[model samples]
Target: SGTAVLTPREPGGLPHGLRAAIALRAAAAVQDEELMAHYRARLEACPGGVSFATFAVPGTMPEDTRLAAILRHADLLTVEPRGATRDDIEGLKAADVTEPDIVRLAELCAFLAYQARLLMGLRLLRNA
Candidate 1:
């Protein structure tokens, strides 16, 4: 039997790498200790590398504290207005994501890819 490959339904949305990174991070946040241990064990058994972290519960903590914790763990942080338009990009350009920040983002992307590959391998092994 052969598995069928599905084509994308849309274009110019979030990248696959970014989506995978988001999913991996969310999975790490599962609160069950048994599940967490299972993930850890599977990750260790897998050939590729993957990393996991438990994100702090939101709203239960102060906004600044939550932001700080995420910043400490995140490789790249994206910020967009709740409702933004083209003109908003200009306004945001001056205030948000400066040149040095972009450079840092590139590095973050690379690191995230490495982590995703490791994690994906582990997840697959677990499913197997």
Candidate 2:
């Protein structure tokens, strides 16, 4: 399911490269090096994925307004999801992000968070 999220059959407005970059960003936010490497590999496999590579770094923002909006929303969802508001959606819309793409972004972020937590739990158990 996570792989599907990253590389959907019909990726809509979000391409595979962008999806990998977003997933990489979320993984990086949690400081999960292994997960980061996983996403990095996926990103490398994607055509033109390197253009979206900046997003993998937590603080790096894009010059493109639409991409900047996406980075902001991805950061919010990854770092502090509880604080997300409708205004964030409005911001994305203002940047020309379509409604379906917004939903796709949310799903990607949510799945990465879940994957991060699962990885953390497994690490803790292994050391226990």
Candidate 3:
């Protein structure tokens, strides 16, 4: 069973840098300090990877169209999923994002949300 497919911890289908960026961005969107630190450290350790400023600060990142699409897609999926529509998807496609890659992005976004909720539940359940 050494498939090494996509997992919350493993950057299987996507590049490790993008995976780390998305994970860190998701954690930042949700204000999950623990996860933020975890992914930030991982990303920073990546050779020639984008820094936090690229993702966190507005209008500071370089001309990274791919990362822009991924970040915007992750934001919509994480922050306002109900508001997401085909247009949102078309936007990614317009930015040259592949369908399979989009699916992987969705998987990553969904998993982050799931992990955050599970962590919150555990914290609450522990306190109860």
Q: Which candidate's TM-score is highest?
A: 2
Ordered by lDDT, highest first, the candidates read: 2, 3, 1
lDDT of 2 at 31: 87
- Runs in model 1 deviating more than 4 A are 1-92
**Tens digits of lDDT, candidate 1, 1-128:** 00010012321222223223333443344333443454455444433323222222212222443223333223223222134344433333444434443333334434444444566778889999
Q: How accurate is candidate 2 locally (lDDT)?
A: 0.91
TM-score of each: 0.29, 0.95, 0.78
Between candidates 1 and 3, the TM-score winner = 3
Ranking by TM-score: 2, 3, 1
In model 2, state the lDDT of residue 122: 96
Best by lDDT: 2
Task: Give one clash count per candidate, in the order shown.
Answer: 3, 0, 0
Query: lDDT of model 3 at residue 50?
Result: 65
Clash-forming residue pairs, model 2:
none
Write candidate 3's Cα lDDT for 1-128 as tens digits.
Answer: 11122233455336756666767777788888887897777778865446443674322344778668777778888888788899988998898888888888887777778888898899899999
lDDT by residue for model 2 (34-118), tens:
9999999999999879988877788899889998998899999999999999999999999999999999999999998999999
Q: Which stretches of candidate 3 lie over 4 Å from their true place?
A: 1-13, 47-53, 56-62
Please report, as a residue range, the 10-residue window in candidate 3 with the lowest summed lDDT.
Answer: 1-10
User: Scored by CA lDDT, what does every candidate get?
Assistant: 0.35, 0.91, 0.71
What is the Cα-based TM-score of model 2? 0.95
How accurate locally is residue 1 in candidate 1, as Cα lDDT from 0 to 100? 5
